[model samples]
Target: MQSFFKTNWIHSLWLILLFAGSLVGETVTPKDRLIVETLIRLNRFDVSGNEKWKGAVQRYARSQRGEEGYFELVEQFSVEAELPELLRLVEEDPTSALSAKSVQLIFRLGEQKKLSRLLSGSPKKKANAIITLIGFVKTPEAQKLLDEHKALSAPATSVAKGAPALISTADDIKALAARTGNVKQGKVVFQKFCFACHKAGDLGLDFGPGLSEIGSKLPKSELLLAIVKPNAGISFDYEGWTVETKQGSFLAGIVSESDEELTVRMVGGVSQKVKKADIAKRTKMKASLMPEGLHLAMSEMELVDLVEFLSSLRTR
Candidate 1:
């Protein structure tokens, strides 16, 4: 068995060389093929061997592959094993495709524990990471984290401001609710922030639940709580699924079929048609695709505006 294993390993290397040679005469470059194979191998190891293979992948990524090449490299290396390193690389050279790839990877990983750690580390990366995670991992833990860290008021307030910085008083909620924020102002704020992950009237990111009927399903207080502290009472229907194949490829999407063929709608709106026979393991993420504390970027007024808009949504 040992001899056979050695023979197969040698054969695999020979095959890789032969394939590389075949590509030499074609438009595909050696670097491109190397990167592709590295991706294939990385997918096979369960997030463990990533460190061994990441250097080669990063080197190839640095080459001037242009937009398409950068995108491909990002997609390939966005796995869990490569995510931390990718995040560091993005910090050093924010323009590198690796930075965006880090965001994309966080979205796909859909792990709130990991995301929360990242958010607690860097405010800027945390903000962007939270936004991306919001579209993927919406859970009570996420919501709770956001609620705890939420900046309810401006950094500072003055006597001329006519109100305390943080409104913890019961009378404040009543006053704020009675104030009736401008719907037009709310629309602008929604378009700028919430619209990217939520849809009300045929607009916003398709990844999140539609808010067209939120008012009918949930009350104003509930809506406010969801925005302020999102992770509470998270509905499981919103959690996404991740599948790992025996061949080392990871796929995530909403599970469309479960019998013999496990169909999943992958990120970027692609469908992963996989056979159950090919699946090695499957994990249902506990977190919601929506990140916690999405409203951190918004001001108190903006949160009020968003709440007003959401409270207006109804099926009828």
Candidate 2:
């Protein structure tokens, strides 16, 4: 019968769509490529273990064009590397915006005294440094010094916390799923936190992976997990990689297109065309370029809302 043939054709079409979806189980998006490129640059610094890059970074920080990238480098290296020289470079020009942030970072780590000592020769030279120290120091000693010197202003010190550790269990994630989330509020949360790097519905930069159709690709639980712990799962072809050159320099970035010549996209959105003849060593990185604790900035309910918004993005 004609009705039976139409029903069979509809079933066949459904099967075809199911098969097509399976083929793209772990496909990469443009945002993934961007994050991989950023990871590449971070990994390059990890692999080389070179001190010379410090000077290069300092110079870049001082430069108007590359200062943003310089700060990102400093933040990543703050825990692993001793960067007294880089600190000195910024401190010497204390009034600059970058220097103020550097001073705040030093004080946060209880190392403002090191900055104070660097300015120690003359009382006149130390006045500006003292003012910075007094503004950022929380201790009684700083107040005593400020009182003794009769310093002009005493701004409140800033307290910073380290990134929150991931503590969500399977039960915790399941509980969150059961809770209701407001999609409209979730959109606001995404704008506040993820809009800068991630793309959704023609909004946001292309710098990170596009989440336009992420809901259909990943389950709600996996989506929640990815937001809290980004390094947990990385898409294929978006892994971090480092290339050591014969000239003793290192290149970091995601390999975009590889063949006779490998194309790597580096941090700050720079593309590197690498030739096989120039390569000394190539290593695949273990850690992901996508930093973790993305959900730390949001409240639990806000995160649930964000997850809800993402989950609603299923393709028809």
Candidate 3:
């Protein structure tokens, strides 16, 4: 009787384990729903001309939109119903967040003619839009417009005091045309000053984003800003900080870490590692470790060359 009872209990436990495994298998999480729902909604919109699915798109865009998915939708949709509305919104209220998003969409669509018309109509909106779009499209037409605007008016100095001074000239046009960066010289400068924080190809520190294609993604002015005033909140990322510990061991640098280790690249080009365990606490310093006078460190022509070098680094 005792032996039979033990066998039955063991069988019951096995059944419970099986049931738990099945339950785990049957339950669907957000990750599972995200791909299927996103794809299904994308396909549904692609097949039908209905704007009904736009709510889903907006939700996705607002919540957790992937770059691939966003660009895919942009590529697939030709109707462009939202764009006209966005453009109208911008015209009515240029400073609206909706207008800014609309301008971004226009640039993403690569509708240069429409963008040009919008710019012609509204100078302030055009200035902001142009600055944003310069990161994406570096076409000759865009360059010409930027040149024309700069010629007519001074480039706005950022509110940040002592912003890196930009010298705008017709010569800028020539530099833009030549696309000249002494890569050999740039490689040396990059290694000496930039490599401690930034990484390119297989070399340099990975504390900063890879610069293999930075030249292609950013304009000369923006790149210069990144070097000089790195803490201007340009994007969701790249804000530099320094951290201090209660133990009186303060580290001034950007925090680059992974699951295993926390790495800090100090302001004066020293890289240090603190074990994840030893860190009692950390605080963020407001300024960027990217030196303020880096532009001054290089000659004007060299700076232009470096800009030329960085501008040419495009992946696509």
lDDT of 2 by residue, 1-316 (tens): 9999999999899777656643664332333334435555666534236544443343333332234454454543342233474466455654334453454345433465565555443345335543543443323444444554443333322212442335468877777777778999998777655654456886553435689898898888888888766777887766777777787645555776566677755432334466788888888878664545556645677877888898887787
Q: Name every residue pair that clashes in candidate 2.
A: 31-208, 31-209, 32-209, 40-252, 40-253
Count of clashes, each model? 15, 5, 3
Task: Give the least accurate 10-residue stretch of model 3, judged by summed lDDT.
Answer: 156-165
Winning candidate number (TM-score)? 1
Off by over 4 Å in 1: 1-179, 266-270
> What local lDDT does model 3 show for residue 313?
66
lDDT (CA) per prediction? 0.56, 0.57, 0.52
Per-residue accuracy of model 1 over 1-316 as CA lDDT, tens digit each: 9999999999999778757754653334455557557667766423236554554454445542444455445444543434566456544543232343344455545544555555556556435534343344233444454554455323211122222234445565556566566566777667655644565886554445778888789766667666655565666555578888897767655676767888765433334466899999888866554555556556677767776877777777
Between prediction 1 and prediction 2, the one with superior lDDT is 2
Model 1: ten consecutive residues of lowest lDDT = 155-164
Candidate 3's C-alpha lDDT? 0.52
Ranking by TM-score: 1, 2, 3
TM-score of each: 0.47, 0.46, 0.38
Candidate 1 local distance difference test against the native:
0.56
- Compare the candidates by lDDT and give the number of the best one: 2
RMSD of each: 12.7, 20.6, 21.1
Task: Give me the displacement of residue 26 in model 1, in angstroms.
Answer: 18
Model 2 lDDT at residue 62:
33
Order candidates by lDDT, high to low: 2, 1, 3
In candidate 3, stretches whose alpha carbon ends up further than 4 angstroms from where it belongs are: 1-181, 234-237, 256-281
